[model samples]
Target: MTSLAPSGHLTIGEHQLEYRMIGPSPAEGPTLVLLHEGLGCVGLWGDFPDRLAAATGADVFVYSRAGYGGSSPVQLPRPVDYMHREALDVLPRVLDAIGFRRGLLIGHSDGASIAAIYAGGVPDHRVRGVSLIAPHFIVEDTSVQSIAEIKTAYETTELRTKLAKWHKDVDNAFYGWNDAWLDPAFRAWDISDHLAYIRVPMQIVQGADDQYGTLKQIEIAEAECYCPVEALVIPGAGHSPHREAAEATLRAVAEFADRILNGHGEAAHGQAA
Candidate 1:
């Protein structure tokens, strides 16, 4: 699959987000937005989104948030509202600036949660659907422990050095995400309350062995969400199902998007058949 060379920059309020667009031209097909994991940027997503867009025939848009990639970097000691800032304020701006009204969202880790928040807030039925990989509403102790382990490994092993190549400000991005997540204040961060408002068709893809979240997260979202939800638990896969089982995850998302776009899938649960 060919890598994407996306034009960057979409302004939101006073801030500009750096973005890339891939796949078939946005004019020819449905657009699918790709949201990266906590420590990810356009570079880290590599060629997966390109392959996915090819398979689905959807134009793909990807970006780095403030302080992550080429976008304007935030000074250190940023507030916890940072994630909220991206989800509530930044995402819409990017979509609107690019003139994509209806599109599929493919998000991983923190990005998945952001997609959920976006889907819930927009009242318009203009959104075609969303696909979540390793999403979370409430942070779990298991996640914390796993994160602790990662931090330890980063210090003791080569993980930090390896990750440094992918991030422009690697420590800034890593600690900015890590410290806030491990903070006690973050445990209370739950978006399950907003699930009922999301009416777009969605697919939740989780790894059975995901170290960051439990299956309860998926169960809660599916139960609370008004939209038709499909859950896929890939056995033996960990946090990054798309990375670990790209073919399977891509197939599931492709079929799900096809169903929704073709009007063959149920929209909200119990509203119709």
Candidate 2:
């Protein structure tokens, strides 16, 4: 895959966030800000964000959170409140710096969790919609099992080394991600209460074979959210649908963005099964 163009950086609060701007020259085509997964950085997205922006004629803003990729490294260990910081503090500042008055949120894995919180915190006018790929609500046996498998691979194979090349400070990125999920307080974590507060349209894309999140996580969000929601479970896909099934992921996001921009008034998408 071709590399994304050099990304721009903004000094949001104490840290400088590394963000890439791709697609049409203007920010007019309904911006879709991509939130990366755990252990993911702007480089980790490969070509999918560019593909999605190209497919939908939308400007996409893909960024690496603090301590990941080219962003400012984390000086201290990530606190339990880190996710809260991203949602409540960092995201708003990013939007303001980019002059993002309104846009859709496309988040995968941990990014999805952060999007839910950020969207929930803001009023409807600030957000157009949200689309989630392989999202999680709370940690599950399945989730833990998957993490264990990843740990095994990291310990016994070259996965750790491979990932380290992309991250300047891989230990900070890896431990910050792994430890946060494994933390005891994270187990009781549930975003359902915040879901009700999001008035914008929402879509969730999960893989039937996703090792991290069970179907119940998506189901609960669909059932509880006050606004219109659509869920799609792609067969044979796994935890990272954007990588495992990039074409379909881009298509779904394009359709969702189209619906929102065209003034569909209500959410509409093919159902999940």
lDDT of 1 at 7: 69
TM-score of 1: 0.89
lDDT of 1 at 101: 53
Q: Which window of 10 residues has the lowest lDDT sum in candidate 2?
A: 264-273
Q: How many clashes (backbone atoms < 3 Å, residues ≥3 apart in a chain or on different chains) does model 1 have?
A: 0
Q: What tens-digit string does per-residue lDDT give for candidate 1 at 154-220?
A: 7888998888887777777778878878777877888888789888877888888999999998889
Alpha-carbon local distance difference test for all models = 0.78, 0.79
In candidate 1, position 42 carries an lDDT of 79
Clashes of 2: 0
Off by over 4 Å in 1: 1-5, 13-16, 24-28, 263-273
Q: How many Å off is the CA of 157 in candidate 2? A: 1.7
- Shift in Å, residue 46, candidate 1: 2.0
lDDT score of residue 245 within candidate 1: 83
How far does residue 8 in candidate 2 sit from its true spot (Å)?
A: 2.4
